[model samples]
Target: MPKPPGKPRPNSRPYTPQRLLSLAVHHEVRRKTQALSAFKDAEDQRPPPEPQLPADAQAQRHEPAAYARRLAMPHEQSWGGISPFAKDYARIVHSSAFRRLQGKTQLIPAGENEVFRTRLTHSLEVADIASRIASTLNHGSGAALGGYRINNDIVACASLLHDLGHPPFGHSGEEVLNERMRDYGGFEGNAQTLRIVTSLESRLGLIEDRAAAEFAIAQAEERPRGMNLTAGTLAAVLKYPYQLGATGRKAGRGAVAGKGIYEEEMPVLHALQALGLGLSPQRRTLECQIMDIADDIAYSAYDLEDTLEAGIVTPLDLVAPDDDLLEAIRSEEGVRACLGPLAGDMHRANTRIVDALTQVFASLFDLGDAYPQIQTDSVEGNRARHIFVARTYLESVMHARHPMVRRQFLEALIERHIAAITLVADADAPHFSRVSVEPGSRLRIECLKAFNYHRVINSRRLKMYHYRSRKILGELFDTLFDNAMERDPKIRGLLLPDRMHEQFRAQGRSQRREAARLVADHLSSLTDSEALRLHAQLTSGQSATFNTYWR
Candidate 1:
């Protein structure tokens, strides 16, 4: 029988070695019980607030119906009702694009370690963090977000779908693809995410009629307008609203020239504008701002988590003053800009946090060296160690008010200089917003990024792998482009599945650019392992096996 809460266990053993163990266990239990009792006593001493609507419920009441309206489709008429935003969430969650994120890299490749985040896990984390930020903004003490209540579902869907466009091997692969398709409105992951959610993902199943599906298909023959997500959800995902070629035209300050929507995706962009999400040539919505920030937060926090678990960098290393790392941070253009006047503050805060973390880690692990070696061999042990390190670091940062103030200063710099939302006069483009990170935080993030950049990405060990991956992609791209130019059926078969091949063929000679785009898309869609396998098959002149062909 189980003992009642806070009840002492009856003594049953004599004072032997086994009895000593039992007493130790009982003493630990008693300590926990006393701690719980103290917690309860403290809670009982505090006065309770007057009962009212839960914060979330209050916030939901202010959310407008227009924000929930679906694009090109009516809400489902079911006894078991669901919000249109919920439908968007369901659709994205069910998408092949979303599922494929599991196989894609974050900082490190997936399957490198059990605790390391992949694009899928990272997306989920981003979604969670984005939703939290939205909820906080909506219900927290801040002034009612200037009459705009962020929808949590919309933010969540946007966050979850944000990295859907990232190809295999992560940003390296993205850079390679972007180079290959430079003429064809270069590949941007954010833009690809927009494409996936708006046009590439199918939503015909919701139409409930053959005619509607055909009409939808006919309206956009080259690429299908995907999930047909609500305007609010779509708006939240449009980190960059302008087309690729229009980068230089009246772009706002701090706006990225290279990252924007593809030319073909403009129709859907216009559709979103028509729905009153107020998309300009270069602006993103508040929800998008929140999601983007959430992404930053997650990446900044988790990347360190991943590196630590992999034993590539130690907490002690970060805390310790390495001239090389400091020089790298100082040299970064973005960091330099932010730390212009606040360089001293940044250094002080950075050093303080690092020192605090080093002390915490040293105390926990009883460090002998300046940089302690972390456990990474066993997955469970690595995870446990990572958790301890992460918790200690976070708690240290949070408690150290100076660092927090410096961080806030950095955030303020971003808000003041980098992030901007302008009210525009054009009826077609009502609101323009740009999201940017301030230099201080950006510098800190860049430094953290540089840790991986110097140690892992550009290291002798990984450089060889990157070089080989690049070669494989380059070769594949050249061969496929040649075949696409010749209109070879085998190449077409390799480029796309049967249904998509028919669509590609339907375009004829005019679709050469489209064919090239298709090749890039096919290459980008492959997992790292899949890309390697296909590369092997192509290079060796071996007939593709079931594993290589099926995906």
Candidate 2:
């Protein structure tokens, strides 16, 4: 070891391995030398386009993977030539990975209560909102988009496909995978989404054609193009334009933090950028921006409905929430950006945020005009009210109106967001349009979105679930990863699914990154119930024999 040229400062801190590892977390090149959980999800947290190689530099031998045009196994080019984006839409919705979203968590875990929105339902809502936003802009500001119209089908595909890569158990499950893959390329939902679409999709045709399946098995080292989507649709689905190992990434914070792409997929992204959007890495496609905001809008409005119905939160709670809660909401990741300069002014920010949210929250319930005013603030006062049978009966009717009132409120909120969406032309990127939400509308959206944080995401109630997610994913990753690392196909084969085991064996012992990725893909594909059942079988030797219906 050598000292620096500069004189050492008297107050300089000692460089322990932990201290160096902590700092190296931000430096991608240096962090590769160390393997620790602390380096988990180190990111710049910027939504799109980190510094990228010149468009030409990214051309890959795997260029055919981006579209259906030049695949070893080609699928239909168009869905009956219905629309330019129609084929991609069919590919997305038809993928088994997309269907598995029904079993994945969105805000709440799936199967807890069938009424709550799973990732599938949330994606559907986001697609609807994104399509509506596209339509709104097309009708209102189409002329402003420099003659290029926003396509509803593209936005729908992008929105529906966005969450396909999310691991089971929601973000907590994602965090666990990210931690396990810290020394690998790092795990992120978006990056995994790309991986799924490009390589890991379970093709149904292969199962029926034994010869095709054997051919796939023989060529396991050469990754298959999953859906073989058009370059334009691929570009539209990329919410974040950066990859994990980009030279520009640095540790930072956001509401959500994870990799956008892996090194394996960068060449495809580069080729797509050259062929499709051609915008700088700093900018996203017009449709991608619409899908991104639609995701936010869906999360903000729909999750609130779920929470209120579950009794985890109430309309009154948002109308007049605690000052601490308001501050906490404003403090959430990516939320301060919605506030502009007002973010720094805590007093003004809280007041304005609450004022905006109140109007939206206040409409979620209705006291029927026929019902006498009831005291709901206190149980004792409510007990006195119950003694008045007329009042009790009227209170039931008033509360009954909430089911319909909330539906109308939900409709109104979705409509408000759609109307506020407009295309703002960017001078820096005239080739593209920037999707802008009216500032006030954006503020209200952020304020509502933050509730998922205050009452659900960051709440103590989910601690056990988080703990379970970490335990299950950690052990699952290690079991599969260690099996692959040992250079024994039989050992890896027993633990991993047949496809992943072969993928790992094909990579051999030298391609540790590829091997680890196979493990990750296998784990990430498991639905919540599958993960739980697999965990039980792997750890306790007990199985869900009665419920394994296909057997």
Candidate 3:
């Protein structure tokens, strides 16, 4: 879906035109009221309250309507008995930020080809997996799960919104953004996602009832309130519970993100804790854990399917692995746990890997099941028969059949893991219980992830793409950074888009950290192709670009 001329792109939740227009002063008012924080010690920006929410936070887990938003807009609350989480799901589904995901990369550059999945498709798939997990929990757990059902809408919405902050070029882009914004509260995709829904989307409750506009004004909030998701959905979307501010930065994949919420969102964080986002096991909601595992399952299994469909890796290639592949697998912590201490002997590990993978494929695919006669022959003959049949009908049947096979393969993989999920009560934790997969399923997921990473993502071809992507993002940041620092308004305005220009205006020179973050936010919001196209237009004199093409 094309982004609306501009929207958080969370769908409308029924604010009247009078109210939306009345709240138009929100952004301006926010700039005046709240000073954007400098890149200071993160603790200085933290809420004064205790580290965790109240002990009774779990008490409200069953009440979806009681979920809190950044701003309390009671007018938006009365959805005719509809749970607020359902509205959040709708808000996300129709959101601009969510739709922009179609243009963002998942693994490969988005919009370059139809075959590779983009962030949007991946999110939708995750949502599908997540909803299933939610249903399984709701039914399987029944009333035994603290007498309250897991909210399916909250889980699905969290899944859909989980990747909202992933910028173009995937993880590499994330790295660059984090480095550039290191002092500016840092840039982790998840944190940026939180920012998008809470601040960037800039939505207010549709004005139909109550003094919603007055409520926001009373709080001195003039900026958009994002999707104003229920505290339940907010907790679910917050897979990471800590801050990724200046002092808290880590060095690896999880390093930059820290807890996945920025210092800029301290108020939102405090609101969540106050609203009873139960504090336990790192503040992860059951829905959040469900979303996290669903993400892992999809990332591990579906990416391999994409690799196969793209002809990047053949099944035979996986069957006969290379030394590098085995080495990669050997180094993974999860794979090591799953395969045991093959230690330095990767050759033996390779054999085990091949055997295990073959077994997996045999159990999951088993192409010969459709042609029972072929199975009656020698195994080699049966394999040959399947190949011959595929080659013969390569155009008519095989081409169409491959997608079916891939789809079925994916479904089987999802089922394998999803079926293993169980609702286990966390007696020591705050929430009633959490959804967990068996240890065996987790090990298998890790092994699949290792295989996909080493074979597909770790390929030299992808490295080259990433290297170039890094360059493009870095250069774009550099140019934009300079433009932002320009003493002359004309030169500054030349490169920056209208939206970014407005942001720069709201930010003061004293808020240099804020300026850096503004640039990072601008860059992070772009799609893969837009990043490339934008790089060219911003860097060169010859290329002319327009926002209409991208925005």
Q: Identify the leading candidate in terms of lDDT.
A: 3
lDDT of 3 by residue, 1-551 (tens): 11111111135455565656645555346556774422122212222121123335545546443454434443353345455567787889888888889988788667668978999999999999988888887787765565566778878988999999988898789988887777667778888998888877855655532233334443424445777776777778776666665233331233332445788886787777676655333446677889999999999878878777766765555555777777787788767776676745767766766665554455433455555655557987788787756644443234323888768766787798999998777544424466667866776687678888788777876888889999999999988787788776555534566666765555534256766777887888888877888887767874674452334
Residue 254's lDDT within candidate 2 is: 21
Error of 1 at 157 (Å): 0.7
List where candidate 2 sits over 4 angstroms from the true fold: 1-80, 202-221, 245-257, 363-401, 426-431, 544-551
Estimate the overall C-alpha local distance difference test score of candidate 2: 0.68
Point out the worst 10-residue segment of candidate 3 by lDDT.
Answer: 1-10
Instruction: Tell me the tens digit of each residue's lDDT in model 1 across 429-526.
Output: 22222334444445555555555565556656556667776787788888767666665554554445554565556555436678777777677767
- Model 3 residue 317 lDDT score: 58
lDDT of each: 0.61, 0.68, 0.69
TM-score ranking from best candidate downward? 3, 2, 1
Query: What is candidate 2's lDDT per residue for 30-116, written digit by digit as tens?
Result: 434543333223123222112132334334221122332323232221123243357568768888899999999887768899988
lDDT score of residue 409 within candidate 3? 60
